[model samples]
Target: MKTILITGATSGIGKATAVAMAKHGHRLIICGRRTAVLDTLKEQLSSITEVFSLTFDVSCLQEVEAAINSLPEHWRTIDVLINNAGNAHGLEPLSEGNTADWDAMMDGNVKGLLYVSKMIIPGMKERTSGHIVNISSVAARQTYAFGVVYCASKKAVDAISEGMRLELTEFGIKVTNIQPGAVETDFSMVRFKGDEERARSVYAGYEALKAEDVAHAISYCVHAPAHVMISDLTIYPSAQSEPRTIYRKQ
Candidate 1:
């Protein structure tokens, strides 16, 4: 069983992926900002397999470095690193966008990912074996009105994934970029700034992808045969065709 480290493990896809990996009988290192939540999750997963949880804000480079460095020697050789901690704050037209929202998105989605990866990648390079799963979004593929900044952040993720694959392939490292569309999670709630009605309406009319669906996809990528690399995967719900085109019932 592989030793997998997943960030943003307190909720949504990250939390789901942690459970999925545990079921695969793999060792797990879960990271998130919420200490109590992380402890609770660690307790839950301990029943299944070996589990370690790190509490740190990925956006803080120092925190990211310190947390990963604090891992036990055995857990440091992470076979899989899932960069799943990211956010989409305040959907609004570019001209009307909140600068604070823009900063939060860029810092958390782009730099935070880089920070965590920077800490863990060296060991993988030395071992010449690893898989990195980056959780991008369908927004990376298509630009929707009022969500330009958020889309841009994910676009950076796509680019970063490609770059890592190109550079790390020779070391036998696999980098997979997962772009999931309209997953029913706290995403819309966060994006809508805690407006329950707005967040609820985002998924009201049709079947949206569940967090587990994306976790399942992640599991598929990491569990592939030794010679197989599921490089890029984009998942959409049956009722949705793309980022901007979703069929809503009357």
Candidate 2:
């Protein structure tokens, strides 16, 4: 069975992807910050597939290294790494934004991705065979006024995917960037800092993509033949072409 590692696997897209991958019979290493939640997922998926869960703050680089070092000896050579641990915070214009929010966004969305990828790459490089999927946002492609920092972070992810692809291709490491638009998840809840009413409003009037949609897409990308790389994919809700261009019901 193929082995896959997923960060941010406690909720939303990452959680959905974990469930989907487990159902497909892939051995999985699930990582997230919440130990309780990760343990619950581990319990739930254990009957379905071979799985291990790790709890660590991906934003903290050292924690990532420690967690990897602590992995079971038998599960170290992972076949795939899904860099999905990220968050968006504070929907406000740059001039009025809080520095803490900016830092959180930068740390989680960009630096967290790098830290996790760095920990996994050496193994993939030695074997010269691995698949890496970085979860990005439509924000990576188009900037929104109030989403400047979040958008910039995802844009960095976009660039990282491309750069890694170029650098690792000869080594037979495959990298794919998945840029999804308006996914209905706790993303807005995190962005709005627990404002459930506001988070719900973002998707109230339109049919938006769900976490499972991205999960299915992720499954498809990874399940492809060894020689074929999906490379990049952009998915959007039918009701929105851009973040600020959503057509909501009147």
Candidate 3:
């Protein structure tokens, strides 16, 4: 079984992917900022496969470096790295946006992914075989009012994924970007800054995608034949055609 390391594995797509991968008997290193949630998830998944948990804020380069460095020698050679830890902070027009929120988005979504990848990539280079899956968003393709930074952040992920693929091709490393639209996770809630009503309304009239759907896709990407690499994929709910066009049953 290949060893997999997933960032932000405490909840949503990350957590679901961890569980799905564990069921396939892969060794897992689940990373998150929440210690309690990490411990709980590790205990739960350990029964299915070898499981280790690391708690660190991916946005913090020092923490990301230290956490990966702290892994045992055996776990350091991760077969797959899932860059899945990210969140949108607030919704407001560009002129009205908060700088703090912008920082959070840039740091968490873009810089954080880079930081983790930087730490794990050398090991993969030495092995000359590994897969990197980056969880992007439909926002990367379509931008809406009040979502400029979030969209930009995801766009950066797309660029990074392609660049990494080109740079790592000689080493036989594969990079895949999964761009998911409107999944009903805590994503909306967090973006609304804890406004549950607002978050609920966003998915009220449509059958939004679920975490498990994305998880299944991720697992599929990881398990594909060695010669086949699904470079980029975009998934949306049946009722949604794009980020701005959702056919809601009103």
User: Candidate 3's residue-wise lDDT over 13-87, tens digit each?
Assistant: 999999999999999999999999999999998998999899999999999989999999888889999999998
lDDT of each: 0.95, 0.94, 0.95
Summarize candidate 2's per-residue lDDT along 1-250 as a digit string, tens digits.
Answer: 7899999999999999999999999999999999999999999999989999999999998899999999989999899999999998887788899999999889998999999999999999999899999999888888878889899999999999999999999999999999999999999899888999999999999899999999999999999988789999999999988767899999
1-250: candidate 1 lDDT, tens digit per residue: 8999999999999999999999989999999999999999999999999999899999999998899889988888899999999999997788898999999999999999999999988989999999999999999999899999999999999999999999999999999999999999999889888999999998989999999999999999999999999989999999999898989999
lDDT of 3 at 205: 94
Off by over 4 Å in 1: none
lDDT winner, 2 or 3: 3
Error of model 1, residue 247, in angstroms? 0.5
> TM-score, each model?
0.99, 0.98, 0.99
Candidate 3 lowest-lDDT run of ten: 68-77
lDDT of 1 at 136: 98
